[model samples]
Target: MQNYFVGSDVGTTGTKSVVIDEGGNILGFSYIEYPLIMPRPGWAEHNPEDYWNAVADTIKHSIEQARIDPRDIRGVSISALAPACILVDKNLTPLQNSHIWMDRRGIKQAQWLRDNIGEARIHASSGNPIDPYYATVKLMWERDNRPELYREAYKIQTAADYPCMKLTGRAITDYSNASLFGAGYDIVNKKWDTALLEEIGLDPDKFPDSFPCDEIIGEVTRAAAQRTGLAPGTPVMAGTVDSVAAWIAGGATENGDMSLAMGTAGVMGVVHKEARFTKNMITIAHAVNSRDTYTTVSAISACGSVLRYFRDTFGQMEMLAAQSSGEEIYDLLIRLAQQAPAGCDGLITVPYFMGERTPVWDPIARAVVFGLSLSHSKSHLLRSFMEGACFALKHNYDLIQQSGIQMNWPLVLTEGGARSPFWRQMVCDMLGVPCVFMKDAKGAPFGNALVAGVGAGVFKDYSVAKQWTEIGASHQPQQENTALYRQLFRIYRNIYEDIKKNYQDLADVTGFH
Candidate 1:
């Protein structure tokens, strides 16, 4: 019988599912977007049912489009946004909307943790900094602010685990996702830090069982099969966090290999065999195997989302033109940006629409466009937007280099943002390195599919990842653009330094706290 695998990525704004054959060929894929609820400033959430339904719908749609028999799908795997906390009952129903990775409502709680637990100790234990972005502070916030929900919570699942429980009736989390649970999981020891949990008054029992990335957690139940259009008893892999999946799919399986995913949020990761605890960067256990290797991640909270914001809020004419001409809105925007010269005529932009991660870790950081004048047109703004996004990545890459970790040249770039030649060129020039795009631009789902294949024994191990990943195009840096970008990047860095304090003052004055 022919065999296939299904990989699903439950992301920040949408869920993507891909059907792949045993050889890693993507047969069909479907993406379903859901709304992000921002009940207050710096808060982000989503109904857990939305993710479950979206996964089921996309799986059904992709299977239908592929024209494949459901029985052929031998295994399923998933990757999801991390540091998100979901409170679910024994029935696998969410007690409330899950707090996503972007939520900063627990700022005070995070600070409390830093003050009480000592930030250095938490980082040593969890391989992550104490911040609102991690699940620990958010879970603490729930316990403090909403006592009833915390009391009724049967299990605190990460975003990936929530869907896994729905599909396989197993409450489990991978080591990669468990590392995001903060001080509770000992990254070095590879177990729940029972002492740490007890010190914080968090029940270690509330956390799910931890597994490796490719470990088969359980089989799909009859009910989940009916709703998701899959055959009952199909094996399911534990999967992992989306960033780690991107690392695998981007062909960064070897140590010192780096992959940058420019999705709604930008993430740059370097594959490493040893764990190093840095001040701002996160050292997550690699998904391939949690025991020996690690991956250092620097997350940019807003990357492509800044372009998305520009499109939704100000690109009405471009949207209408694309609609009439049957072109993609991003393509039209790229064409419009081409009219503006490099450096955006001395204009600089900071892409912090949703604050920042990595390096700064400031949740109150705000977006700023400097040196704007009547002379600058919307096209210039658009060009600056692309440049700013690239600059943010460069900033993180520089920090990684400063940590004495040098990545291999020709860094593999994946995700929807890498599909744009214009943006890829910008990243190459700004970072002064050759950037290579992969053939499969479908980001984490493609990676998740490969993990499913590995777990199902259709493939022997993760080395198959390199065979599945192929280079599509290489964008080399132009010396002229590189020199010009360095100058602009200096100003970009300075502007953030000058105005970062103002962001908190403004947020406080505006009652965002």
Candidate 2:
């Protein structure tokens, strides 16, 4: 019998399951979506049970769709949302509602941490700044605000590890998730740094045992088998964060291959042959393996969702059509944007709809639409949206490159955002490099499977796994647009520079939290 592998990705809105033959062709895949709960403003969460169901549904559907026997599945892998703090008791049941990656309840704690830890010191120690988006501040907030809840919490795992724990009946973390919260997980040493743990005042023991991303921690248990419909005792590799998993799928190397994930927010990551960092950006172990490093980070909130917002709130016609026709509203937006030329004819947009994250760590930042003219139409507005998001990435790309890390390759692109040829070309034009779009742009699921393949001895390492698994299409940068975009990018940078004070003042006035 031939060996089959399964890669399960737990994304923000859904869990996706993909089955791959030994040579890396996707046999079949399935996506099971669950509704998101925004209980309060700036808070994002999921009922842990919802996530588990999503995982099980997607897996069973993928296996059945592939028409493959479960016994052929020799290995499994997982990639998950990062910086999500889910507390589970010793019995592996959730302690409380999980505070997802988008939760902002730790803002004040994050602010206090920035002052107490000092930005440069924290960066030097953890390769990350003190920020609310990280897991530590979330954990700190729980410990301080919900003391009894914290005491009752048995383990704190990332979004990816939690489901895997349920599958394997064990608790463990991969390098990618452990390092995100600035909890002193070291990329270079491949171990948790005790000194940094002391500095952050976290219990080292509370952290799940760290494993190399490709290491086989255990297998599917009878319980997980019944739930997910997989063979009991099938080997499941410890997984990495979604972005880390993506870097592998897209072939981001340490020298500087960059993968920009545009989902609810935008995340950019580059693998470094050597560990590296700059102010505001983070450097951590790659999700696939410890031997390599990745400077994982992002910005441009409401990135992909920004277009959805425009269509939903503004383009109500398209939104309704999208719902009825089973086509993305962005597809219509992209076609319209393509009708307009480069530069969107003097429209400047800042995709700060939900405030900025990476490159500029300003939580107080507000979304802006500038340089709009009377002649501008929906096409111009649509084009500017894509351009604006690209500019945000360019801003960070410039910052990440400054760390003096050489890119392994020019560009690596993968994500749901790649569904549009227009978006893919726009990124290439903006970044002035060829972005190889993985034809199978399933993002994290493909990445996690590659990790699992390595762990189960199907592949040798992250690089080798990527070499065979990734089949991609390339988009070379357009020189003319690059020149035009350079000027627009200058203005884009100036907007942030010109509006810093106003952002702070806005934060003061609109304490909406």
Candidate 3:
């Protein structure tokens, strides 16, 4: 019998699962895409039941594909998109749709916290800036707007915690996810800040217990075993945030190394020995060393989503051709982009479709396409949109450097976007650095399985993570493309400044309800 470990990643667009052996080789993989709910502008949500179903289905699918006996699955771990607000009642039933990271409906609550408590204080205590993207602001929004739901919720959980609770009947959150709580978690002290919670009028018991990523949370319950096709005694490791899992998977476990996860959102993270609080980007406790070290994240809300939007909205012919020729639509788009010029003939797009994060932190920001001309084609549009995303990432990369975080060269690229040679080259040109690629960039799920292995004593420690990850190719920047991208990136910055106030004006004019 072959012993295996299972890992699940609850992401923004879907849930992905993988089965891996002690050697860190993936034997099976599966994904289930779900819909993102948009009841109104700047509001994104998903039913908590959907997450539970996705987790169960994907786990079963992975095990079936691996041709493994259920009893041979020794351990499991999960990674999830953080700052998601999942409130549940006494019976652990969801109160309503979860407020995911993409949602920005808590602007009023965020400003209130900033004005009342001061942004500097929040940053000092939480190692993060006060923004609608964090959990507390959304909790405040529910407390103020949906008071009934707020009063009835017994415990507020993160996305990763929810699945763990279902599997183990234990309500607990990992340090990485707890760091995003609005009431503030002391990164250095490794506990929830009681004073901050009291100041915000939040009950401490309402939050779940926090633990380190590799610590075993509990054994899989019989109910969960029946639902997920796993053994009842299988150990469940306390997992981590999705980007941190990507970091571990990319072999950026030590200081000075960096990792980039370009999934639905673009996340750039660097591992550090000490916690550095900055108002510019998010700072969270690292999964590997939650007690002493930290991970700083610069997140862009919609990088891959912008590309998906173009494919769904404008690539009908390409989609049809791909179906007939047995080629992927993304491959067709990449080919089309290759035919276009590097700068897309002066076409520019600012991908703020769901506001902006990281340096700008503007929830009102909107997407814009400049320099459109009659000569432009679909290929140009696609390439320009990709360039726009690169520019956004460059902004965050520069901010990370400006914040005094030292990084080793050749940043590791892990996730779906890393598979595209054209996209990797664009990132190289925009950031003016070499990008290291990995052979199995299956991302968070793979990393989660590795963590499960460690927790189950299948591996010695996280230090063995480097042995599991292998580098594939290195993409060096073209000096000419870098110079050109620098100029375009400058214009990109200026364009945002020039049109910054117009976003609010448009919102006001449209009666932004």
Candidate 4:
């Protein structure tokens, strides 16, 4: 007689699925990673078929691992990377690969919008800035370059909506995801800005209708049930973006609550009761209260991706050591980083390998390692790399504060990077804030399951997520480390200001842009 729910996160790099009981305890979990298609420089894409297959596979695997009957599942929900434009035909077949959030090929389109439509007008309407990161610019790029594909498309779908359509045969988006569409979704009014869309020369009909994040959109069809191993009639909720889901799972429900999700991208979400839209951050409707609350977010283009890049590009010796010894290469790298002292002996890195987002919004920005000396070892470089990411985060936080947003103390950190105590402590020192993380953090899938539970009436409300989340560890800022980091952070900020113009020059000379 116990009820269970299924939740899945269709991420940029992969999909994660989990089965949890009514109590929010994860009983089953599975993750499947797919390749990020990079056809050209600054372009990122994904095959829609890969998303559907991964969603189905992960759901089946998680259900099987949970040892539970699919019929007992009350509901299902999904979280996904947002603002991805996937064009589908009448038969729900993708016309082409999706242009994901990381794709920066729409720079010209974004610039056109700023010139013609006006950046302030667009930002005022959508609560998002004019950037290639938005779906509107990407769609413009598609319409301009791939006119045939654009003409043949029936509807535009996001990474989350595509999977939900496959599950329930309904092409719909949630408010949170819809706000980031940037094609004229009015975040404050909670409606499509028809005038804005028309001014931008986009067909408003191409976008789907949006619902509340927890609204039960539809039930799984027989074909979807066969594919996902769920009950044919199991209800599915319209879910939010992956970072928002991770924020919910980290127990951030009330106004002023803050969370940091350290996935491939570092996303920081701050929940507020009023719609305080700032150009410094991306604004979206809160998954918990779609109407009254807003979650403003700042994103770093690369966080864990930078670490992975280092491991793949520079950690050959550590990788070989791991092959010889039964150990994780990440652990070995972290061990090496631990050998270095605070501030990494005057070495600093600006982690802009994939350009940058939030506050800076620089598309041509590249990574920089400054103050490198012969005395600096690989360990020092490794540690400095980590500190660099933290510095970028602090940069965003400082800007957010300057914009008159009050941040709640003891920020909650979640996802992969938060799993490391050393990294967590580094964040504490860098941000100069006490931080706590959830014990046995379940990531976005857990929050998706909670959304399903709410929609299915298995739980009273989302506040239960906090009751279910148990704090694992807490770290206070080390006064000495915080002081040193404050000094280094200033230089980190100055380095970007000094060389930001050079990034574009380098790109123009090399034709990388």
User: TM-score for all predictions?
Assistant: 0.92, 0.91, 0.92, 0.95
lDDT of 4 by residue, 1-513 (tens): 989999999988899999999777788999999999999988899999999999999999999999999999999999998879999888888998988988998999998988898878887888888898998788889899999998888888999999999999988899988988875888887888877788888888888898999999999999999999998999999988988888888788888899897877899988888767877589989889887778889999877777798898899999999999989888888899999999998999999887899879998888999999999999998898889889999988887777676689889987778888999999999998999976666778998998899889888788888887888899999999999999988899999998887987898799987
Ranking 1 against 4 by TM-score, winner: 4
Question: lDDT by residue for model 3 over 406-468, one digit each (tens)?
Answer: 788888887777778889989999999999877786688988987888888877778767877
CA deviation > 4 Å runs, candidate 1: 64-71, 312-329, 373-375
| Full-model lDDT for every candidate | 0.85, 0.77, 0.85, 0.88
What TM-score does model 2 achieve against the real structure? 0.91
Which has the greatest TM-score? 4
TM-score of 3: 0.92
Spell out the clash pairs found in candidate 2.
254-271, 254-272, 254-273, 255-406, 255-407, 255-408, 256-407, 256-408
Per-residue alpha-carbon lDDT of candidate 1 for residues 46-119, written as tens digits (9 for 90 to 100) = 98888899999999899998889999997999889888899887777789898988888888888877788888
Q: Which ranges of candidate 4 are over 4 A from the true structure?
A: 320-327
Candidate that beats the other on TM-score, 3 or 4, i.e. the better one: 4
